[model samples]
Target: MTATKVAFTDVKWTMLVTLHMRAMDSRQAEPVLGDRFAAEAERRIDYDFGSWRMRVTEGDRHLVTLRAKRLDTWAAEFLAAHPDAVVAHLGCGLDSRWLRLAPPPTVSWFDVDLPEVVALRRELYGDAEGYRMIASSVTDPGWVEHLPTGRPLLVIAEGLLMYLTAPHVAGLLSRLTTRAPAGQVLFDAIAPWVVPTSAMLSPLLGAFRMRWALSDVREVERWGLRHRDTETLLGHHERVPSTLVRSVYGVFARVPPVRDALRAFRFDF
Candidate 1:
């Protein structure tokens, strides 16, 4: 069988990095987010991922999987409460979240991303009864129109917000929050310090730059949505590369600034 060619460039190419992270975890004996689909996708793709092998450290994969697990938990919880929910995964990339979650037919799921990315996804996994793919920039307000309304909506924006500017982020939130009757927006964000810290990863990041940062959750509240909760990946009692680093993290995790360096937030409209 011929492998699918992936020629995504610029920000679109970063999707492979996240996909690779999940694929790496899936290969683990005991994975955090056991996503076999991601592993298979990695094997099926023709692109050479050797360049990212060293770039994506253990800590990076750990944090990313943990963050995704948290969101997956929240999404399942939301679906339990509102079985007829509308979930729009912005900047969907090649992540097999829809397949992993496996929501019931009552729930409407949409995987949204760029045209090239969506095209590749369609080739990988075709459309289903309640699942659809939208090829458009998440930054574009018009894309929101494609989503069905009058049901509880859950917007999942993993590894997406940081790439957009403050205004773009605000506009996106406004569009999602205003349209949906009531629902939550789940996303991970880095603190202001982490924005500059991304510079250390210049080679891995390519041409993309981290634009937005969240100092506090309250800042999002000012945008009209009420803050639901905030969780930091650092505070989680999980295995790290070294016991000494875990010990130090346990100590510094108490510090608000250190804890908030990278966090996952949920806000209800």
Candidate 2:
């Protein structure tokens, strides 16, 4: 059946991409994340995703789960120290991350996203105590106001930041760094110079042209947060898929210029 119940708008439509990626991961021979909850959530969506062709090879598949898997790993580590840490999942799609990551019982997790996206997520996943679905853009100055205070916080931005304007992203970075003061943040992106041509090459991002892209990981240091990695997050993983991607990444990672095809950074304030 075709989707007629709702139409995804602007950045909200991007959520389906992550949902589809997770669904694809579940079907892999050796799934990276193995998020069964993601597969189930994809099933519950009435939207028809039969024609979207983003991941065309095993290499693409490995990259998809790598972003998510890294974020999940970081979350686990943060929660291990501060079992009651507040997790802010910005631009959270139909990810079921709280369900998949399974943070501690005392952990406070917030799924912050667009109004339409949050509404859809509520329908798909329902409401749970300590887990919230905040309906607002991550750029909002007051977005930080909704999160719990006086607790260790970990902000997971996953595929966000790039789509926003420079000022918007700057404002958000300032807000996050100031509001939380001390915590971790996980966000991934290609360099600004590359992002202009990225959409043309990747069929998935072809339609949605991102608004802003930063060229360097060090740029974020201006926001008072330290960039944790110089290399791409995909390369440092323990269990990289034994595909041509590994070979390509192995060689490309040797270079200083082209190594950061997709840069992942964890920030410490």
Candidate 3:
């Protein structure tokens, strides 16, 4: 089979970074997400991943996988209760989340992203009986306005909000909450400090600088939803090679600011 060539650049190109991380983690004996589809997708894509392999550390890869794992856990819990629901994976990118969740036919699953990314997704994984692709920016409300609103909604915005502007995040959340009768939103936020830190250190992250930051996780409640839970992305994972390094991180994870550096938040409307 011929590999699919990707033309994504700038912010859009960053999706491949997360994809690469998940692909690498899926090879682990005890994977966090065990996203085999991501590994397969990485193999089918015709792009050089050498730079990312060199620039990103094993810990970084684990963190990426763990973040998705936590979101998956939350999403699965939500779906268990609401089997007949609408799940919109905003800024879906090339992540094989729909394949991972495998929601029932009664559940309407939509992978929402920019047209270019959606085009790539179409080639990688075509639409199914209950799954469809929406080619539009998550910040733009027009596309989301038409989503099925009769059932419970689950909006998964994994690594999306940070790239959007403050107003865009609020507007998107507002529009989403207003559409569904009741549902949940799963997303991760980086502290303001992470933005400048990434700019100074990592070229890959500097390419698409994170524009939005949430110092307080409770801020989302002000937008439209009630805060359900918050989890810090730091701490030692089984994949981290060094025990000493893991212990050091475990200690730092106790600090409020350090813990908030990157966090997963859940909210219900």
Candidate 4:
């Protein structure tokens, strides 16, 4: 007989990748890291759920997967430009971006997360020549000082901001911007209009053990970072094609009013 295992808060959430990978099935969602990473992520999710208490839905799965893939594409492009730079993935969770991007030998990649997540990452991926895992929350400024200076840096905070309070996120952005001489940050934010609604539904979602902390896109500017550009992801990628967008996203793409309102924004420093 199998013994019951206690659930821990430190375990990386698998629902994060479910949305994007499922969206890939429609052929409308163009995933930056391709299929292998998505498949691996799904496998990890399945493994974790088997051993722990977690819940995911078809919608949640699709959104998380698409968001991750989009961010992966953005991070890959940044790394490609600065081959010798340092790449930091804040709240790294159990992602395999280093494998997907395959940075050159010269590039240094750091995966930052809570201590528990770091332990899990070590257990799963081990260490490599240039890949390092730092067990520290991004809000902690001490980690920034340790990173190598004198080169462009690319910091990625996929699905991180939403979980943070406004002040904490602002503080983190300020610290990162000040520390890196030249670098860009790629992150997602919801518009102000969507936050209240999301918050209202949070309780119901929480009943199922799912909760969301969303951020307003406009609030990012308060961090003193330059606003670059914001792209609406639903049908933005050319590779994804229109048919897949319509089929996978369904009414999400068709409802002009809702599509306009519920869009993700990208910001830079």
Highest-lDDT candidate = 1
Model 4 spans > 4 angstroms off: 1-6, 10-33, 41-56, 201-204, 207-218, 236-245, 248-250, 254-257, 260-265
Assess the local accuracy of residue 200 in candidate 4 as a C-alpha lDDT between 0 and 100: 63
Residue by residue across 1-269, what tens digits does model 2's lDDT show? Answer: 33325556545666776777778778777878887887877777777566534343223656668878877877788889988888888888778889987776798899988788888887778877778889998877787888777777888887787777778877887776666647887887776666666557555445456666667667778767887754375575445546666677677668755766577778887
In model 2, what is the error at residue 102, expressed in angstroms? 1.1
Global fold similarity of model 4 (TM-score) = 0.76
**Poorest stretch of ten by lDDT in candidate 4:** 2-11
Candidate 1 collision pairs: none
TM-score of candidate 1 against the unseen true structure: 0.92
The lDDT, on a scale of 0 to 1, for candidate 4 is 0.62
lDDT of 1 by residue, 111-219 (tens): 9999899988988888999999999999877988988888999999998999889999998999988878899999999889877777676575554468799987787
Query: Which lDDT values do the candidates have, in the order given?
Result: 0.85, 0.74, 0.84, 0.62
- Looking at candidate 2, the ten consecutive residues that score lowest on lDDT are 51-60
What is candidate 2's local distance difference test score?
Answer: 0.74
Off by over 4 Å in 3: 52-54, 57-59, 201-204, 235-245
Enumerate clash totals for all models, in the order shown. 0, 0, 0, 6
TM for every model, in the order presented, reads 0.92, 0.86, 0.92, 0.76
Per-residue lDDT tens digits for candidate 3, residues 128-205, read 999999999887779987698778999999989998888999999999888889999999999999887766755655
Error of 4 at 62 (Å): 3.0
- The C-alpha RMSD of each candidate to the native structure, in angstroms, is 2.2, 3.0, 2.0, 4.8
| Model 2: lDDT of residue 32 | 81
Give the candidates in order of TM-score, highest first: 3, 1, 2, 4
